[model samples]
Target: MTRQKWTTEEQEVWLEERKPAFLIANQKRCAAKSFYPDLVKEFRDKWPVPPVTQAEIDDAGSVELATRVKRDKYDKRTSSWYPNNTRTLSAHGGANEILKIKSQPQPRKLQAWQAYHALTYESKWKPHVNKAWTTYKEEWLAEHPKEKPEKTRLEVMVEFMKGKFNEENDDMKKRCEEYRNPEMQAVLNPAKAKPQAAINEAFQSAINLLPRTLATIGESLVKQTGWNITILAGGPMPDTDGTILTYLSHSGKTKEGDSFDKFLGKKDYDDHVLCPFEKFLHASFSMDGEDDKEKEMDDEEWKKQNSESEENENQTENVDQTKNGNKKSVGGLSEYEKSKAKNIAQLKLVMENLNENYPFPEDLVPKPALKKPAAKKEKKEIQQPVERRASMRNKGGDKDRYVM
Candidate 1:
């Protein structure tokens, strides 16, 4: 049985597809570095060796010539075989190069480049990336101690990228706002706000006044210490009520009786205080400057007292243990007899090594006197104050009172 060649019909279809097929082949050859311009020309010259047109031949002899032309030019050769060629594609040797022309660099969106730059070399972003790297690597290893270094690095990078993008895009800022106080929010609104028009009202009405509130702090510090101080007020002053409450509540000595309300002479400031109008403005703004030094001192004192109380308790426990051991008699032996028996072992060791330096005096010593046991301090349960009876009768212009 003879294998049939492609008919004219099959050949035509193959011919039509040749260009794109050739391009694909060329790409593979180029990737393999076997398809230079010279090599491409040689390949085109060798393979698509176009057939002699039917119009070029005119008779039976020419038809025989065409058959001969097809056989000699394509069918007879095993190299670069395709549709009409007898050789199988898989049997043919592949081009040395498999890739085509260098791929044109893909066009990047501005946002993508911005992100890449932030990742690789941005100075400001480097610190955050470094921080993420340190935290993730340590935590990942701590959680998955047996993981390989290569796997751990990849995992760390994934978590770090997630955190980095969230922080850079202001997601962290939004989260921080959830925990911010109402008074702080009022002052921070302008800083967090966007656009000139939307923020203008919040800015002018609230944020703009922060400096004035801060200035009053400096004024108060000067009044207190008579020395200049640097003020770092980041935002606008609080509202009037917030200001007044802050001043009245926090100003003046924490010790009894020197409160801001009393110092300013709430009822008769016009005569009692020299500068009534200035005091009113200062008090109105609620600008009680922070005294960190005083707070630190108070904390130290509290810690000292707690430490002392702990030491005293430990000492009392030691004293009680000694007293119990001394007074209890075991097997009818007196307290003195028990002490002698305890030292008997040590005395024997001394005798066995007479030449060795003695651990204690030649005379067998008694254990030191047991301390007196501290009296067991009984805790008295506290009694709540008794409620007084309410008077139903209305009295002339007097408010209700209760006795302790």
Candidate 2:
């Protein structure tokens, strides 16, 4: 029977699933097969072949055999299978290549490569690096060129232990391997461990002093001056241990403590203790003054001037009040003098008014106490209310009351 030709769709499907090794296997008997002519010729040159069937070529066993051969050859390169120069691969240097294969120390029961493969599938690690085992292994080999390429982290650790202390039958080959783990190196080296305690103590001391220093400074400034200074405490304390570690960290000082939640519940009761004397010295000069004696004299003179001016103002005010009292005081008129003045005014006014027409009211009659106007003047009404008028009518009330 004549074979049916594959349709375009069937040809596309064949290409998609085609394997070079399978195609090469089939070319011997299936001369009409169009796929992989170059691959068939290449495989035939590399491996001797008797007549092979298409069915046998498609079988997975053939592909498995090809893969195993390739893997075994690759394994040989990374080992001492050939001379060092002859075995050199293009990508991996020969010495390093062999090291990569054997570097991973084996578990007692399993080889290092087997341990790596098993660990890759282990439930804990599979999530981080799942099917990309080849890429991960390549990258690990690149970083740890000095490390045994075949060792797992755990296996490397064991070998590390044996090399360090196992001197009786020390394996020189194992000890030559270098593992460059910075963290591990630090732990292994004794010199790195000594200063760590002092560093830790200093850090603890600084953290503990942060709150106490702030509170003390705040309380001292308040007691010295009446002005209530708002000390913002969210930042490092100013001049803590007399060190200028930083300037103020808090924003403008605020009355609301809720704004500085980090610095809550701190206070101090001590009298103002100055930040250490070293803080005041800007190189050689003191902040308060270079010459203490001169500064003291200046301060004393300033105080004396303020005191004298205040006393002078008080004395001048008292003298002005005394002069005002003398002006307000007037002697009382005599009763006899007043009566004689009234009689003389009555006779003169009667003689002068003999030609006047009508009699005036009895209360309207002139008295010596009444004064006559020298010329015509405009009369103004007194504006005081009745209560004010009544108060003003009393004699002692005028002297006791002061007007602005």
Candidate 3:
């Protein structure tokens, strides 16, 4: 009988459905034949061929003989003898090759929702899907190197959700604006709007000016007098326009303790202890006469005038003595002169104390040597009184004096 060719539909049905069923049934038969010798013989008998003749056996080469001698050789086994047998169907050539070609897996086609569900819920398909996606991304990037790759499945889903939320929010805002009732409109508008407060421009100007003015004055004082000034902390005060203030302080030590906390001020700190300390520093350290040049010039002019007056007075006294016999004592110095003299004396004392305590730089100060026994004895005598005076001074006074 002549074999009939399969139509397209029949070929598809056989490949998609009937082929797998046939494979399973043939496998079962093969397994059964392994246990039953008669079943095996029956399958071999169905595809019978003539036995090898004596001449053909003699002509067989060594390799062919060795291959034929193997017990599980395809031709020798009943399992692979029949066409529909699982082993025959799985073989590498002929009908087996056709089956393998037909059985090549079809590319799965899924709807968007189905694909999402499969990716999310189907663990078995995840590896295959990930591998396919990676391959597709690489190919797409190769084709269009400049464009960014597509968003991931999860990212796309998240963006979809965000878009839905924004749409809902916009609808809500529109509904709020379109509400007809007056109370509802007022409620919505009031709830959405920010509140504003009334501002006093004049008060704000003054508030802002206060700290700036104070800072300017403090800076000028520091530059003129070389006093170290520090603005420790500052901030604006609520409900007081734009008023900002800072805590003023210095880094010196005082009799009580640190001068920083003791001399703290909100404004006009230059008028306090800083001014006096600066004056004392300038006076004590004014060796080049740079700080008090004007004062010195005034003093010289006053001294010249006073000396001329004294000379005239002396001439008058001499004339009186020559004319009368007795003269009155010269009047005392003026209050300004007395005060100036006192200040000069105080400045000299301060300088002397500073020299004794801190002294000048080591390079400028002379150091005594005590290499010999005689010099050592003299050095001890000199330092003994100085150390004793220092100890007595430390014990007598408030030792926490300002450092600068």
Candidate 4:
């Protein structure tokens, strides 16, 4: 509409007559449907909820002061973790204020951790990791004459293993051939591999064997305290990404076990426990034959290891590129895409609000010529109704609950 300065009388009349108000029910209002109740219920159900008190919330924050205090405490302790050491007991001070999430390892016939770190560790491993490391290191170095690639993790690991086992290297050419074999598939793509043989002998010795290294797969979301709410997620690789589980596995033991689920203590907290996150050094990332530390680390002690690897390893075509990339690619946005998608969503919601009665102006609204918003995919069925399960409080007297 063309604008013209309104006279005082005209402005007064417009204010009195043109202002619009629709007598819509609260249920029909957009604000009513958008958030509040639904979001609140979901948040609360996510349970042992965020600290119930202000003091706990204040204690939970990771201010420079808290970080420094935590660092000093951890520094004084018997460990060499980095500057912001989250593992210190100081870090767990107001922890219950944070919502904790941990991967619950599923009982599996074979876990990669067992296969890779077995006491008979070198048996099935030598054919793959060493060869791939030697091969990739050579080709990568040769191709880039000027650029000295930071040694790949595998290369560093091979060096460590060679010295530890007092093992000698095979010919470089022979190593390359081993790397190329079909059976060495995990060398190229770690997600799939001949995980250590999980035979009965391995299971029998598991308390003594599986290297749930003290290292953590990811950093703790909240480091300055303990947690009240801990959500259990199903880990895809089952303890591969977790810390030393030997003793946790040890405590859960039966005269005959591994056949039973929840045998591992944290596997049910009734149980409890976690790290660098990505920056882990002391913890070995090798897929095979890591040197053993007799004091097998447990869930409670997980958050205490190296913060990161020695360095951010280079990505090469020959390794970890062939299989399973969808692992991290399913989320959207450059904010621009998100802004557009969000705008479209808002427009559709506006259209619903107008709903044939109170229509918005033609040019301002998405025009009839413009394409309609894409239909939303149906939400996946909740095969497991785990909602509200976390919210249930401990009511004291024993009661049987349906897992389903």
Most accurate candidate by lDDT: 3
For candidate 1, lDDT tens digit of each residue in 1-404?
75654335654464445545545655576512442333334444655546566663553258668756654545433223332342334343452233233464764432432343333334445566667667876777888898844445445555565555455546544433432433443343444435655555555454333323333444444344333233322212232222211111122221243432343354442222222222333333222352111111233443343345335443432122222121111011011122333344444544444324323333223345434444232112111211111231122221111000
Cand. 4 TM to true fold? 0.15
Q: lDDT of each prediction vs. the true structure?
A: 0.37, 0.33, 0.39, 0.32
Give the TM-scores of the predictions, in the order they appear.
0.15, 0.14, 0.14, 0.15
Candidate 1, which segments miss by more than 4 Å at Cα?
Answer: 1-116, 119-121, 149-155, 166-404
Please give, for residues 99-197, the per-residue lDDT of candidate 3 as tens digits: 111343653544333323322334343555566557766887999998876767565444443443354555543453343333444354444223433
lDDT, candidate 2, 1-404, per-residue tens: 84553324643343334444344544454523543354334434544343444554465368666555554443343222112323336455542242111243542443333333333224334443433445556788799967756746555444433433344233432222221233332343444444855765666455444322333343334333322233322211122322212111121122342212122322210001011111222222212332221111233342343234335443432222222221111111111122334544554554344325224334335445323443233112222332344542222211111000
**Residue pairs in clash, model 1:** 31-98, 31-99, 32-96, 32-97, 32-98, 33-97, 210-236, 210-237, 243-286
At residue 355, candidate 4 shows an lDDT of: 49
Instruction: Report lDDT (Cα) of residue 240, candidate 2.
Output: 30
Q: After the best TM-score superposition of candidate 1, give how far the Cα of residue 266 lies from its true spot, in angstroms.
A: 99
Quote model 2's TM-score.
0.14
